[model samples]
Target chain A: MGWTGRILAGAKFLAPLAVLLVLWPILIRAFNVNPQIFPDITAVARAGLESIRDGSLFAHMGASLARVAVGTVLAILVAVPLGVLMGVSPGVSAFLTPLLRFFSVLAGIAWIPIATLWFGYGFGAITFVIFNAVFFIVAYNTLLGVSTIPMQVRNAAASLGAGRWTMLAEVLLPGALPNIVTGVRTGLGFAWRGLIAAEIIATNIGLGYMIFVARDFYRTEVIVFGMIVIGALWLLIDRLLLAPVERATIERWGMVRSA
Target chain B: MKSLAIRNLSKTYFDAYAGAHVDAVRDVSLEVPEGEFVSIVGPSGCGKTTILNMVAGFIAPSSGEILVGDHAVAGPGPDRGVVFQSFALFPWKTVLENVAFGPKMRGVGKPERERIAREFLSLAGLSHAAERYPNELSGGMQQRVGVARALANEPDVLLMDEPFASVDAQTRMTLQEELTRIWQERRSTVLFITHDVPEAVFLANRVVVLSKGRVLEEVDIPLPRPRRWDALVESDDFKALANQVLQLVRSA
Candidate 1:
């Protein structure tokens, strides 16, 4: 597509969001809603500016993003190689697939209580939650991706003089990339939610912490501002970072015809 | 001397769940002289692909032996290049990169491999599409790239498994002509597998008819060289040979 077409596509995505923003303030005024229950648009905006001016908003954002980054990177580094190793052997993959699935299901929020107890309610506990959220899903996806490569492609590579290393680098890795990337996207999503939950329960500095602390003082404006920041930050991360990576991998490696 | 020899090769699959022994290919033997074009024609489930896979060393024969020149076939290697029915082009790689893959694996230098890949891509009539990924091309184009990739390895033999089966009839015919032209220029020994009788008759100097995991007949085609698709298909000799092969296949 041309530049104009891409710009139009971006505009199309933001149009609904623009409409929602316009409706929010009107709804609050029309209902005469209590500020304690839900702050008005002006109050939330002022709280947002105040936090930004005091530099607390940046600190919270940095803390949250850093934890997600460290946890997710660590998880990917460990999971991908292990998954590929397991996937290369049918017997091993079959034995471990159910186990991986079971753990993935029990990942993320479910581990929050135990993580806090083990790590004593700080960075370790929160990072552990995020790590748990990303690890199994990425591993499972990598395993599935490697296993699903057609035997013909592998045979073609082998017949063309591919050694073990060449097979892994050229055939296995590229073939499995679409699945691995998709795994990362999904795992990151779970990690994002887990980060928020962990921050609320265990940490003292993050968006989730900021909102949770505000709730005790009935500072609905601050809570509302923090919620908006969380939503916008997640949208940016997904759209700017994770989504594009997923899309590029799928387009480059997936066999689906490009439209 | 034959470029490839298969001696009483066989394969059997044991179905553990059903407790039954199934023979896929049984006591099949064939030989192809150097630079010869041979097509194996068989009905579905007649073990034609099994034989091809064995030749490619993707699968081991349950009995007997296969030899390429003086060496016993032990496993897949660069000596034989295989073109699959599915094309098997790596989607992530560009057309040129896919062709270069073999030479790269063999530890050829970057510049030399790229030059080899470019030459083969042009030979396949795809130099214009060197940068395009596999999914971006049509089925026929992808198969052409597959041919180029196999040829790029400079293998002693080319093993093709219904390489044009997935393309439309028109594209398949074009691809066949292109393949014949390329083969004429390169003079590589080819072993093509297909169920299409007309295709087999058109392409091969000898057609080996197989059925129920056994060789039924070996028919020679005395069709003249530099065969043109329109003229050859119109000739009485081509039709007669095709009909004879079709009859053999149907009866088998």
Candidate 2:
């Protein structure tokens, strides 16, 4: 795009942020809120600078990221193919779908109690929480993707001389790609939230722990800074990474409906 | 031995709404000769697609026999290629991959299969879009990929179900002509199904009119080779044949 188009798009994105910044002071004054309840923007900025200078921010962020990576990757590697297997047979899919749905509904936050009980308030518990947060959702989505592929496409592939293996590789996987990617996006969102909650509750060295530890000392500035960091990190991950991947996959493999 | 034969073919649905017994296609018999282009024209809900599905071995007949070259079709095999109306190309697959699917499925080696795919891709006039994904192409182009994919198997018989129904008027005309040209060159036995009379008359050497899951009449098109749509439009023979086919369909 031309510079004008780029400028317009940038402005479109920043407009909301600008409004939030302007409204922050009004919100603070209108409620007569103490600094302990909600720190001013400058205090939060100073806290952010201090954390970055001390390397605490990077350390916490890195630890959280690693746990999420290990958990989600392991989940995907196991869940997708298993989901496809269940999806291929209607009887299998029908039987398993309800079970998976039951598990998926009880995913993420609900697992924290049992996970902490079993794994004992550390990386193990946190990782387990993240894993299930992603696992059940991803597997369910993958099953939906595989099973919902139009029967006509399967028949078309069969008539085109595609064998069982070829049909799986060519028709089933490609046809289900859009749904699979969508599932990954949604599952990751849940996993991110679960990671933070697990870190606060069970772990001692991640971003969530940093915020929770700050709360013990009434360090409102640090808490506000951490919240900003969390929001910014998620924005970056979703906008720069997952959203683009989802859009590209949809454009590539999805049925494009012309307007 | 015919290229394809169906004897006492029947399909019944036993749903509550359809009642205990509802025969979709009842005791239909037909024979498709080798290297002949045959079109089956039928009214809506006439079970033409059910018959095609049975022949394609996607569905089994309720009670009857379906034979291709002395072999009873137990299930879908590489011998019969089907071109569907929906142009059901794998969206993730490029035109090349879609066309090469048959050979790939048959365990043909990569280099050989790719070469074979490229050749047929050219024959279908889709050589330029070989690298493009299915969603990136137009409806007509996608249908050509479907045709190329079917042809890749080099099947003894090709079955097309309303292949031109989804495309626009201009593309549909072009595709129909292209299909006839490809059929002439390949000389594969083709059973083309459509509800359009002109399309049936223009493409097939023999047109079978079907209504209520049974054959109404069969009309022979003796039009000369290299048939152009514009020239065929001017011919009295084309008009008369189209009229007769249309009348049969309307009455049905």
Candidate 3:
């Protein structure tokens, strides 16, 4: 869509959320709720301004974002190649799929105790949690992507004089790219959520720690402000980064029929 | 162009459902001289496709061998270019890139390969479609791209597996005439597999009718060059040959 069309769609999408924001203060006043129970919209806004002015919000956000970025990149670098290998070799995939499924079932948060014991608390532990969230899922998806390529296409490549490296580069990789992108998108979504939870237990400065510490002093406004920032950041990451990547792969390949 | 020869070729595999060995092709042999266009026409299950796959080295024969200028078939190679019925052009590639793929694999540099690819695309009447993706083209156009891709490799023998079977009748005729016109220029040895009798008579210098995995008979079309359905439609020679092949297929 063009700029004006995109802006209009953005406006339409935010309309309902704008209504909720307007209603929040009125509802708090009507109920005359205690500040400890839930902060008023104005109080939450003031707390958000204080954190920004003090630079604490930026510090927390930066740390969290860095961990996520490092962890996700590391996971992808390993996962994609491993998945392609598994896809090419059915025996290896069959042997490892059950093990992968078992580890995946143990969700990222479930690894916290062992992760801390192995790597100790802080960066090592938190990064391990994020890696766990992304790795198995991305690997599984990559395998699925590679296997879905038509056999005839591979045969065509071979008959065209493609050697092992050329076949992988020209046929296997591009053919499986759409599926690989989907895997990364989903895996990263989980990793983002897992990062927040891991940071609560494993780190001293991060979005999760920012909110969890507020509960100790009845700083309800700060807690609510942190929640909003967490939600908004995820929205930005998905919309600005992941969705475009997925769209590029699928649309560029004509993997999906155009509507 | 190189001659293609198949000797004592056979394929037999155990049918799981039948619990017995069933022969797919039985002791079949054939020869095509350099630059000859030969069509192998048969009904479904007559093993024409199986024989083509063996010659193209997609599958191994149970016995005997196939030779392309005295080199025995091993596996799929750049020496034998195949055109699939599905017109298996890479969807991710533009028309130019798809045609360039074979040369690219052979270590041809970018400018030289693109030049070669463009030459073949124009030969196939698809120069205007160089930047378009395969999915954007009609079925007939995609098949043309397939032909262009195979020819760009300049293989010793071209193997086509029902390349026009899925196209609509009107478009099929255009593609057939186009094939003949290109063949006249390139003169690549080709073994085309198809079920349609008139198409067999329309494109080939010689037609080999096959049934039950063996050769039924062979017929030659002395029809003059620059063959067109429009002109050949009225000729008694074309009808008699098509009828003769049709009868052989029916008898099998």
Candidate 4:
């Protein structure tokens, strides 16, 4: 991109955020809400300060991040290979697609009840929820990705002296990358929601638990503060990681038809 | 050694609902000698692509045989390279990587593969675009990478099925010239299929015209090489042959 384009893009991203910052004080004053029901900027700030001072914020954040990291990595490792294997044969793909879709539909927040029952309400249960959330969606997307690669391309690859393994590595995997990345983004989004929900219901620590615990004591400031942290964390991940990866794949692999 | 031989190669497709079998390519026989550039020009639906696909081992003949260097064709192998009409490049890979794919698949190590890929890239005049992915390059450049990839395998025969059909006329001319140059340098047996009469005349050592899924006639081009593009077009013989071939294609 040109310097002017880059600068304009940066400005566009920051403009709404700057406006939101400017409007914050007015919003707090106009609401006339109690500190216990809805925290003023100072109350939330003080809470944030207190949490940081006591190191509770770090501990919770670390636990949440660790769950996401472990769950997502495990899901990717299992889902991609299985999806590709199932996709190689049309009969297998046709047979398995409906089953996968059914499981993927049952992914995320819905898994909480069973996961808690199965793993007994702690890190294990939360991680299982996250893993199931990402796994089914990613596998479904990978299958779709591999299945949809143009047959002509596969024939072309084979005729150009590509063996079985080469066909899989060169044609199948790369062709499926855009869809796989898309699946990861969507799967991760569901997993994040499931994590939050699971933490609220089952875990003793983490951001969701923090909010739920605060709710019992009518600590609305803490709840509101936790919601902000969740939003900010998701924004950072999507913007900083997933969005760029998606953009790169689409731009690189998408066939642009000229008029 | 015979580069390629197809004996009574017949392929049938059954249309279940219609309760009739379609003979896509019926009893087609041809022998291509080593270092020959042969073009098969035919009408649409004359099973030109079906024949090419069978030779490439993408499909099997119902009752016939395909022999490459005395070995019966069972499946696609590295000995026969194919250039597809759509270019069919792996879009995610850079030009260098696409060209190197065949060598890499054959277990050639990185440094040697890169060096061989570089040679083919230069041969196709795409050395400058090595790092650029297929989507980023022009249609002409993408086809060039396809050619480079096919040649990198060092096959005994190169089968191109209307490789330039999707490109613009100007780009097609340049690619035709580049393909001719590559064929001359490597001397690989070529079985090229096209509907364009001029393209067949320009590139082939012998033009085998097909009509209604049969060989209508075979014309020895007798065009001398190293051929110059502008000069070949300006020649009276080239124009006459092109017209004769065009008439046959139109009639078919």
- Model 2, B1-252: lDDT tens per residue? 139888989998776985687677888888888888899998878888999999999998898998888889888888899999999787777789889888988889999999999999999998999899888889999999999999988998889999989999999999988998998898889989899999999998899888888888899999888888989999999999999999999998
- DockQ, all models: 0.78, 0.71, 0.82, 0.70
Please, what are the lDDT tens digits per residue for candidate 3 over residues B1-252?
799999999999799999999999999999999999999999999999999999988889999899999999999999999999988888889999999999999999999999999999999999999999998899999999999999999999999999999999999999999999999999999999999999999999999999999998999888899999899999998889889889899999
Candidate number achieving the greatest DockQ relative to the actual structure: 3
Best by lDDT: 3
- Worst-scoring 10-residue span by lDDT in model 2 chain B: B14-23
Ranking by TM-score: 3, 1, 4, 2
Model 4 off-target regions past 4 Å?
Answer: A1-11, A254-259, B16-19
Chain B TM-score against the true chain B, each candidate: 0.98, 0.97, 0.99, 0.96
Candidate 4 lDDT over residue span A1-259, tens digit each: 6789978987998899889776876787898766776777777778888888999988888899889989999999999999999879888889989988998988587888888899998899999888998999899999999988888788877876677787888899888888899999998898888899999999999999999999999887788788889888987899889988887787788643321
What is the descending DockQ order? 3, 1, 2, 4
**What TM-score goes with each of the models?**
0.95, 0.90, 0.96, 0.93
What range of 10 consecutive residues in model 4 chain A has the weakest lDDT sum? Answer: A250-259
Candidate 4 TM-score to native = 0.93
Best of the candidates, TM-score: 3
Higher lDDT: candidate 3 or 4?
Answer: 3
Q: Residues B190-236, candidate 1, lDDT per residue (tens digit)?
A: 99999999999888999999999999999999898787798986899
Better of 2 and 3 by lDDT: 3
Q: For model 3, how does the per-residue alpha-carbon lDDT over A134-240 read when each residue is reduced to its tens digit? A: 88888887888888888778888888999888988998889889988898888878888888898888889999999999999999999999999999999889988
| 1 against 3, candidate with superior TM-score | 3
